[model samples]
Target: MISLSLPSPAPPSFKPPNPNPKPHKPKTLKPSSSNPLHNRPIHHLDQAQLNKAISTLDLMSHHNSAADLLTYSLLLKSCIRFRNFELGKLLHKKLTNSGLELDSVLLNSLITLYSKSGDPVTASLVFEEMGERKRDLVSWSSLISCYANNDMEFEAIVKFIDMIELGFCPNEYSFCAVIKACSVKENVWIGKIILGFVIKSGFFDTDVCVGCALIDMFVNGGCDLESAKKVFDKMPERNAVTWTLMITRYMQMGQASDALELFLDMVVGGNAPDQFTFSGVISACAKLGMLSLGKQLHSQVIRLGLVSDVCVGCSLIDMYAKCMVDGTMVDSRRVFDGMSEHNVMSWTAIITGYVGTGGCDKEAIELFSEMICGQTIPNHFTFSAVLKACTNLSDLCLGEQVYTHAVKLGLASVNCVGNSLVSMYARCGWMENARKAFDILFEKNLVSYNAIVDGYAKNLDSDEAFKLYGQIEDTGFEVDIFTFASLLSGAASIGAIGVGTSKQLFKCLMK
Candidate 1:
């Protein structure tokens, strides 16, 4: 048992202590035979062994083996590496008890630990507690990255502004983080400013990663695909990831042919496409229903030995499903049956393709049953897809089961899930159940309102449809073309027109 001189640990408050707290210097201890870190090899150990080596709090204490700043930093990194929140908090206690004023390095370690552990609020507090002068490049970069990685994009941009106000030069990572913040918020104006900074920093031409992230930012953030293309075209070097992202973005932009053409260009340019690239190109082909191109990509997948990849297999299923010949999915089902492994995405793709295509609602429902009976947990999309099967079958019992399953999975409030529930019940002539589901919805989108109103109209319940219409009008939900179409259809169906009546009189007057 070793007793080390330590300052009193601060109260659990996160408030910044006096910046100039009285410093207590500990007397250096001789390496003891009982000390853990000194007893074994430290440098050659991997992260797991390193973690296990320092598992005990007393083992790494300041008095035991004369631990220094470097030792504490290494241990903090372990906390982050292992996502060990309790150990991180213990280190903070040890840090305060040791009376070492937490500087940028140690503070950044704390920020990284908390951020990786999924506690961005504490990371922000640690950063804010730093004195004005103590906020260094590492400090700014760590805090900004903390916000960005944790999905606090707006706060990340705010911190970047603060970093710039302090006259600290940002590195390429800082630019990447701020640019990602812009992408998340779709703030092209701010993204352009950050791009200009990156160019000024000379990272635009030299850093490949910076260029790739910028491409996503421009297209996704700026909503300007041409700008993204310009950035991709001018890059001094492009990797597989860059090509894959561009191809995926092209598909997202409705340029499926362009995505395939780019894939060809990549092969011609001598870049071997990876799983992600193949997945994107295959998906593009599926969207365009280009069976010939899809087959060609499939052959390439076989040649590249990617036939076993779950992503490529799922893409193939989607492509085969969409590229129908003679109005049957014989080829798609065959391919799906051949798959040796199936994940949640795999199940989801096939279920959606089955139900969404014409006249396969029964098959989709069966696949969903299999998915439920298997190890794969059905996601919200799976529930949504299977619920459409219920709509087509008009099985009130089945729809209710799906609704119950959705609630059990905590997806009852998801817009797609909730909308599908209303659609299912309405299609089944179960208007009472539909109304109850609609009322319990946490939030309603236009699709939800449309489904319910259309359900009422299709069930010949025009009164209920009009009642919901009036409610939604005051509720501030903007109606779309589908809404009017359903409403007019309901109105026309609710009354016969022009049987030598008022509509006939109006027609005669017009003539």
Candidate 2:
């Protein structure tokens, strides 16, 4: 063995004063041979390769101080990208230990990370801490944005108000967030207030995003046509979304003719109709029963190759079904069957169309059953159409079966479904069932009571019918022509002369 020269320990007098002596200057980490970029910020690294690089760096004990701070922050960002909260927590600990947790950029990143990871509590905590530490606008905006995007609308609004109170002006992004929140809650009043703020902030004219949100808010809030038109007219610029909203607003207000006229103007204005615009035009045509105009629009749709669109196709089917012509129903069925994707609305349109034509009850029922067999769940509208068909046909068995199914689907409480049920039972000579349905109604409307009373009167049960009529009167329900007709008929059937003196009840019908 090589003789290891054991250097004698330093002489007793030569004391090693304070073995762990503090350096005059803080000892800075030198660049490691393993890492040439150790002194540089890790944010400069390719984010895609960050995970593997971080793992390798973890194994290496020697790392530059500044590089460690930067690398840990970048690594936290990567963890956020992957939504790996566990990894983020570990990196957070590292950042805290490295004295970078209070870093504004790092805290902002962490806030966004927690928000995106669906950890709003943590995001909120980090945000509060950031504010306590005097962070910048970006940090504030990040937390507000996270709250808004996370569907914490109330929280987001509070944060926005807080931000404003803090003398921090919101950017366009902040306005968009609050506007979207108002839109979601359908709080048009607040939305209008925000619009005023947006205008005062000078964000409305330059920001298309803010403009779009404003238009959406007005339209969705059931704003009047004049209000919507004013907004549209005043817009310095318009996009496809703006035109679509305007068309939709007209359609919703039952101004189908105006909607069609606007659509033509849009075409003349050289804005090509997108699928949504065509769908709106088609719906207007259907409502007007304007088969001729509807067909013209259909031609345009085909030319634009939008016939395959589910919404447009459904509208086309509806329009054709409403056509007064004999073979128009065939066209409706053709459109329906040809649809590559048939949702509940497709089936509903065809069934309602068949019911409207007065001899296709059997076909309507078959289509409804086929919808169920095709694994397409029937909605309230579907049941309503089928029930109407059953009422027209006086198919008691089918009507009751549909009622059972409606109950199974938890749609029996839907007003339309309940009305249809009462009508079907009354028309099918099941007065007891009709009364039961009427009784179960949470809201007893005049039409519903009238339905039951009229059923009894039609069946020549004047006494029972009169009792219901009295009940309706007791409830302060206004007697309409139908009510009077049913009452007069009931009294006349029973030879009660007093009912005839109730004022020219049948005069409207006579006229």
Candidate 3:
């Protein structure tokens, strides 16, 4: 028993005796022989150790002695570092009651603690309490960052402008926060205006972080991609995040070739691509069906020891499946099997690859079963893929069972799952059940109509097939090659190809 003077712990909702309580004199204590923590520096302790120290302080009575502002500030820093919101709130209550003055440093720490805890309201309260004279650059910057992180973009931007109006020079962190706010608000005008300030501040060329934020502002605000590229190209220094953003944006814009080219440039620049970059570039390889280049990237993936990442594993599976060499899916399976664990995305990717690759229906179904037995919940895409396997194998019983499982999971009415259900039932000669599934769909797409029309045509139901064909235009979907093929096949089977049918067929051929 060693006892240190400190405020006794109180509930989060406890109010102090008054707004400005009289300060208590703090008496320094020497190391106690009984408590090991008495000798240890508070700032050097990890979060768990700091928590134990706080617990020891909490047991002391308010009348025993009081901790100085520095000790309280150090405890607040630990709370923010560990994101221990409860402890921080308790400490806040104690600090307010301890009669220690709240300085700029402690107030900034409170703002950050509340901000990181997703309590922007409390952070705002703390900022307001700092008063105009005591608020420093760090206080304003922390508050702006708090608003930006909590989706209060408008407030962040306002605070930023206020900071500038108050004769405070905006720093790199300040510009990044405001720019992110503008990006989220989609206020391209404000974002461009801020870009000029960024140029004036000289952070655009020197600070990689500020440049990345500008690029993100332009790209995500739906502004011109050219502007984003111009900013990216002009940046004197770029980090891995910078390269990854450009690569990802290129892939999204369907410029896979440009993305791949940029990736080579990135490698040449000596900035090693992270797992995210690898995933994007590998997907670009899949999109272009570049088997040889994909293999090279795969080698890099293995060398960098990123082969076990779920995202990388999924991309590799997709790339191998799409860029198949000799029409075999051995590589995809190898990657999937090599992963240490499987998440929903990884399982879905492998199953989708199997379903897309021909003659692997049984393997896809088995994998689906394994996924289910492993207690991994399957999403709508998983159900859609497994149901397609049932359609390919014409296993009506298995399809019905899977359908039951989907219904139990409350995903039966999802568009993708419903479309697959219709296709599965119709292909297995269950037209009534297929129509039932089709009618239950919450939102029908062109694919759903195509599946039902093709099923009727294949089953020799020319009347229903023609009826559905006439309604395609009414549903705002253009008739495609699949629609024409189904109609022609139906007419040919029933000897119903008349002048009108011939004219339509000719029109389809012309298109």
How close is every model to the real structure, measured as TM-score? 0.80, 0.66, 0.68
Per-residue lDDT tens digits for candidate 2, residues 106-163, read: 8888888887878888888887776555667777777877877787877877888888
Q: Tens-digit lDDT track for model 3 on 1-511?
A: 2111212222245545664476764433334333444334352343257676566555543335556666677778888887788988898998888777888999999999999999999999999988998899999999999998898988999999899999999999898888888885367789899999999988988998888888778777765679889999998877778999989988877889989888888876677788899899999989998878888888877876788999999999999999887787899999999999998889999999999998999999999989989999999999999999999999999998998999999998899999999999889888998888888789988899999999999899978987887777788887788988898998898887898878867876675
Off by over 4 Å in 3: 1-44, 47-54, 60-100, 326-328, 341-345, 358-511
- Residue 276 shift from truth in candidate 3, angstroms: 2.9
- What is each predicted model's overall lDDT from 0 to 1? 0.78, 0.75, 0.84
Which is better, 2 or 3, measured by TM-score?
3
Task: Output the TM-score of candidate 1.
Answer: 0.80
Clash count for each candidate, listed in order shown: 0, 0, 1
Name the candidate, 1 or 2, with the larger lDDT value. Answer: 1
Ranking of predictions according to TM-score: 1, 3, 2
Steric clash pairs (candidate 2) = none
lDDT over C-alpha atoms for residue 438 of model 3: 85
Of 1 and 2, the candidate ranking higher by TM-score: 1
Top-scoring candidate (lDDT): 3
